[model samples]
Target: MNFKKIIVSAVAIAAFAGFTGAASAAIREVNEWGASAQFLYWSAQAPNYLQNIGCYNGGWTKTGPTSKYQVSVGTCANGDTFIFRVGEKSSFDGPLSVMGSTTDPNRGSIDPQEGCGDANPRQRLMTDETTCSGASCTARKCVDITVGASDVEGESFTQVSHGMKYGPSTATNNVWIDRAFSAIDTSSLANTRKLVVPFGEFVNNTVTKNGVTIDNLTRHQVVQIYSGQAWYWQDFGGDYTSLPITRCFRHAGSGTHATLDKTVMHSPWGGALLTDESLVDPLTWFNDSSSDLMKCINTIDGAIGYADADQIQKVGAGQTYPNVSAVKYNGVMPTRATIANGEYDNHWAVQNCYYRPTDAEAAAVCNAVKNVPSSKAGFWATTCEMTYMKDKDWTYPVYVGATCEAGPSCSDGLDNDFDGSADAADTDCQ
Candidate 1:
């Protein structure tokens, strides 16, 4: 007999003997639930968190025929699955569960609101450029080719969720909000509740053209750079031989932009150092895409910019940007410990989940969605801003929020919220 026949016969014999092998021996099957959601570009780390919770059997699979944003699919063990798409938070003005084709007039094209011109470009796969078919750039459409009902295999996965880094108030004023109007008060419109959790911080980096790097910068120096007060590389130090300090920033609708402005640029008296002339400088570039922003920094000499620390880890780790380095703020490097302990005073961006109040199906999944960090033991004590963070000993932080003892014996001054008075002396004990 052939070796193939002999192998098949051996496998058949094992099956007949009721032998159960490793999990990889057979295909894993699932039949529980599925969902689809659209979220902000900064939260690109979200898929990592989802995959860690076993929501996906193996890992996330990237799929999308459009360049406007990113799309990833996760297949669960119960036959349930989910799809995630990345876009500016402002563009998502409706329910997280809205299902439509890539060709639909509203959902089909990237509009001018996202800093692209008003030509209404079609979505490319991974590039940020719009599609134009005609000679005059008149015929433009998104190029996404994924088509099918939101449901898979004729069965429906009932839960849908939407995520963003900013709150509804900020989302309303952004020109990219794609709803008929930018009102986020869903109390009258649908079943939605604004869920919030402490998110991650952003870190600004001072990169050189090639030879050298600036290790740290004071808040005042950063303000001067963005405000046009510091225009040349020599202004900070004679660290590099490059001239013309290049400043790059995210476009106006970005959540990172808002956070930077609030934390780094704002004055003590409710003012800003960046003037109109500085913001509108021809030399500066307002990039709308994070990848594009990184590319800009990598390609430009003497370039300086800010991005989510987690985002930088995702791309800046082993990719391009060989000449660039992250700046330590006030002698402290950006890390989960620094941010958690409030050592790094800037870049505390948040993660929010919004769903319609009437959508009970979406609401059902809120626990798994909101408790992403705490769900995994020692994953994130009270944060959901990154894929994962370990302490100095490389272990998960101990979570003491709900699990903290609330009664008389539990009161300890060292533990927060326990009231300094220990034992029965603390009101918490009573």
Candidate 2:
């Protein structure tokens, strides 16, 4: 049989087998909250098919829909079987027990918010309704709590959460966050500092520096830069001896910086450097500019810096300096696979968060903030004060590599495809 036919037949066989199980008295009720509320109902007749039948709080719209109520069919199924494509807070409601047969998948109904359903105090403001004038703002419509920088440690990363708590504040215009990497030439500086490069560039640089196989390094080293222990090149079994370590970090208020801190330093140093004042808190070992962080790593001996992989590539290609080296963590080198998998745990986290201001003005201001076009743009806008660092990189570990076949993907970075592969090559490798 042809590939298409074979695939279809396999699907049919699986479907048939799935339905052959004894009729279940359970009905799966999946509810999604944030930006919109979506519910899916499943019974035996539709054991494999979930019908999108109800909605509330927000409805579908042309420009962008928001309402106190809405419902759509065929949007989700089996409760936790879909990802929130839009960046919004959400939760699954139920897997209530019901009598269901393959001929009739509908069994029973349950409240969408019955269990620990998803709910965010923050709601995103409609784009057209917000405006920012100076630091103050106003929102045209009602909204959640206004999101402000909290004095609490780690609050700099809580913009969306706070915005939802105090939104609809005001309509205000602010800077847009952009994602781009800056170049640094260590040769130009009198003192060379160690820079921490992202996992990808670190791996390539490590290969170039030691002539070792990149794959030999454990995935952990590629993503995270451990403090102190992995400081010297010799630590990784490399030949370089007198490498002066220079710490590289994103701009003071960049989300990338926040993510790195959260992943690498949140445990031992939880509130130490992650306060509202120092948004992008590096390890406190080295100081370098976000633009030249990578270049510093490339040109300086014993240099280390952290940067987005894409930005590192750009700097390595365009700059006049020599390429930098990345250190390996636990023997695994950083690569697309390691990053996709949690094996290379680093500072980055899943980028998903939302907020709405209760104050009309704040809501309006929150709405005006748009997603950054690139890492470079995000970095620049945060530096320019057009946007706050909090909203730029709000991420959760949910939906890391989840697929429709299983429950919603959680942030642990597993292969939900059940294809025997864990992350990179899995069918659910998004």
Candidate with top TM-score is 1
Give candidate 2's error at residue 234 in angstroms.
Answer: 2.2
lDDT of 2 by residue, 242-354 (tens): 34333444333234454454554454443323221111222222221233345445544444555554343354444543465444555544443444344454533322212
- Please give the distance, in angstroms, between residue 359's alpha carbon in candidate 2 and its true position after superposition: 7.3
Off by over 4 Å in 2: 1-226, 229-231, 236-242, 250-253, 269-289, 315-322, 325-347, 352-430
- Indicate the residue-level lDDT of 206 in model 2: 38
| Cα error of candidate 1 at position 304, Å | 0.5
For residue 342, give model 2's deviation from the true position in Å: 4.8
User: 337-360 in candidate 1: lDDT tens per residue?
Assistant: 555455565444333333334433
Summed backbone clashes in each candidate are: 20, 107
The candidate scoring highest on lDDT is 1
Instruction: Please give the lDDT score for candidate 1.
Output: 0.37
Model 1 ranges with Cα > 4 A deviation: 1-62, 67-211, 237-242, 267-282, 314-318, 370-381, 384-430
Q: TM-scores across all candidates?
A: 0.49, 0.34
